[model samples]
Target chain A: MAHLAMATGFLLILIGAWGALTNRNLLRMIVAFTIADTGVNLVIIAVGYMRGRTAPIIDGAVSAADAVTRIIDPVPQALVLTAIVIGVGVTALMLAYTYRLFEKKRSLDIRDYTDLKG
Target chain B: MIKRFIALALVVAVGSVFATLLFGYTPDADLNLTARYYAERTAADLGAANIVTAIVVTYRGLDTLGEVTVLFLSASIVGLVLAKGTHAPHRTPVPVGELLTTGTRFLVPLILLLGVYVFVNGHLTPGGGFQGGAIIASGILLLLLADPLKHFSHSLISAIESLAGIFYVMIGLAGLFLAGGFLDNRILPLGTLGNLASAGAIPLIYSLIGLKVGAEFASILAALSETEEL
Candidate 1:
């Protein structure tokens, strides 16, 4: 099941990449890039999950020994969470730049905003 | 049309054959021993039940530090780009909806509290400093959007960010001086496993990270929202 989820995520990422590269609208491209980035993060987190494991906690129902035995790996979850937050930050910055670009160029089309032709 | 269809089919067939030959599926072996070893060692040395947090904040703290620096650098670049002799957006002075303004005024404190709680209890639970810090920044963003008239204090945010960043570096260097390695956890007492105070230097480092991230994000939002000409 996890493998299937990872495969789906990879598929999404590829599609997103295609959309980002081929899309004419700058906003749509940014959205596609975000989708691709999120798909990658999802694939990473999915890889950390196991078939039938509890959360990594040693509480009343589960002893430390049992916790060790039943829990899926949590390291990837933590790392992915961090990556997701950073992704949000980057996306926000990208949106801000997009806004600025739109304001200056007065258009959302990528081809229209090309001022750096040399 | 027939020739194009034949070429497409041939390409697909060849790609599939190549994929099957190059990347045949292999059954993965269960590595119970390695998992057990890591679990036991993490529980013993890290003193945090959440091995993920332990590994991120302690065992691989240097990496986390670098990650935080990356965030800082990105924020800096954003600020620099936006600051380049640009005028702020024309202030139309559009009246904010009273519902949003009042609702966000009520929500800000609660969100801030929740963010702090998440950061402080990171070692014991699923959430950590970076997540919590970003949450706090989101709250600030909400406030900024809802109440355009209200503004964050720039000097305070800058001071806090710089101080937090410098303090983080100083802490890592102190660890290097005391424990002979940057970001070593030996400086603080590694208390019992699963305790809040356990994981020496981890919580402190994460707290610094949270502070830095929060301030940097808030400032980035502020810079973007500024209506004044640069």
Candidate 2:
């Protein structure tokens, strides 16, 4: 299951990167970046997954003393939580830039706004 | 055709590297030293049933603080970018159906309640502030869809955002003075491990985080919605 998730995440990243690189529309590229961010989150979460192990939550089912053996790593979960939020923030920032770009250029195509191109 | 071939080649190259990494990876049979320390000591130290909450709000609290700041910055930049211009394009008022409006009014409170529940139980459950905040923002999005022309009070949203952020910082500082370290969970008495009141300041911090995140996201959404096409 972990391997499958890892593979899926890698595939998503590849597809997203391709779309972002090749797509002409700024909004489409932003969408592609969001997809890539989701893929990165998935990859990070999957890296910590253990077979037949439960979550890191210490409850009745998983005792505190034996949690090291029973529970998956909590570090990755914590890191990924922050990563996901940060990803959303970045995507929003990029979208804001996109809005500004559109307002200035009056066009959504990236090729149309090459004022600084040498 | 050549572009498609090159793209496929690039995908294959990148995919192969990940595949190699995946093949080399092996799940640990036992937790690493740091994870083991957290797992064993979290309940005793913080009295939080969920170790992830302990780690997020206490152990790795600084990183979470930085993450929240990043979100706040992004939302502010978005608001700045979409600020009303000298020549604001007028929007046509579209009437929403009564059924949709009534349904949104009925559902918004329940969604908000669910978001509150999720964050409040951060120390005892899988969900936390980030998830709950997203849920609350989705509820706001629904409201926006139901009544497109209705204005959400920017002042109210900013007030909640800033207040939550200030309270979070104050709580962190209080922990620095009263507890083992910064953002320590021991500032408040830890009730029973599985109880709602348990985990000391975890619930409080999570609630503040939830409110701030929800407000930031809603502000971003409102800014985008207010943008007029040129």
Candidate 3:
């Protein structure tokens, strides 16, 4: 199960990287980046998974006494929480930039903008 | 064509590295040192039902604070970049169908309520501030989708966000002064485990984080919606 999830994550990252590298439209590139971001999160989750354990929550089903043997790693869960929130914020910023670029150039294509101010 | 081939080659190389890592990786039979420490002590040290909540709200709270600051910065930057002028665009929005408008009205209140529930009970359940905050913002999103021209008070959203952020910091400072260290959960009497009020100030901190995050997201959504040509 761990390897499967890890492989899927790697596939997603690769797909996202491919799309971001080849896509001409800024919007597509952003979408691709998010895919890659999702993959990174997934890989982290997979790395933290335990074979026979459940979630990290200390509930009735999994008592606090035996939590050491019962629960999956909580560190990765916390990291993923922060990552997902930051991902949203980053995506929002990306969209904002995309909107600005669109407003200025009236184009979503990346090649339209010239960097040389001279 | 050459650029595309190069991109593909790079992707392949990266994928090969990933494959190697995946193949060599063996799932840990035992919790690592840090994970074991959290698992063993989080309950007694924090009295939080959710171990992850304990880690996020208190154990590694400084990182979470920085995380929220990053979010605030992102939201602020987006709002700043998008808000061109005080006046909104004057274009009339096409009427959304009755199904969406009515469904949103019926569903939005429930979603907002659920968001509150999630964040308020963050200490015990799987959900926490960020999840609840996103849920609340989703409700706002639904509202905006129903009426594209809907104008939410920017000041109100900012006020909520700012107040929540202030209180969050104040609570952290309180931990610094009253408890073990900064963002410590033991200040407010850890309470009984698994109960509603068990995890010291986790619920309070999480609720604040939820409100702050929700307001930031709502403001961002409002800013973006306002920017729409419709």
lDDT of 2 by residue, A3-68 (tens): 888878887898898988778899999999888888888888887888889999988899878888
The residue-by-residue lDDT of candidate 3 on B1-230, one tens digit each, is: 99999999999999889988988999999999999999999999899999999999999999999999999999999999998775456677889999999999899999999999999999999999999999999999999999988999999999999999999999999999999999987779889999998899999999999999999999989989888572
Docking class of 2: medium
Collision pairs in model 2: none
- What would the per-residue lDDT of candidate 3 be over residues A7-118, giving only the tens digit for each residue? 8889999999999999999999999999999999999999999998999998888888999999999999899999999999999999999999998989999999776645
lDDT: the better of candidates 1 and 2: 2
**lDDT, candidate 1, B46-165, per-residue tens:** 566666677677667777777777777777777776765544456565677889789898999998998888887777777777878888998998898796655678789989889988
Q: Judged by lDDT against the true structure, how good is candidate 2?
A: 0.89
Please give each candidate's TM-score.
Answer: 0.84, 0.95, 0.98
- Fill in the DockQ of model 3: 0.86
Model 3 TM-score (2 dp):
0.98
Tell me, by DockQ, which candidate is best.
3
TM-score of chain B of 2: 0.94
Error of 3 at A87 (Å): 0.5
- Return the top candidate by TM-score: 3
> What stretches of model 3 exceed 4 Å from their correct place?
A116-118, B228-230
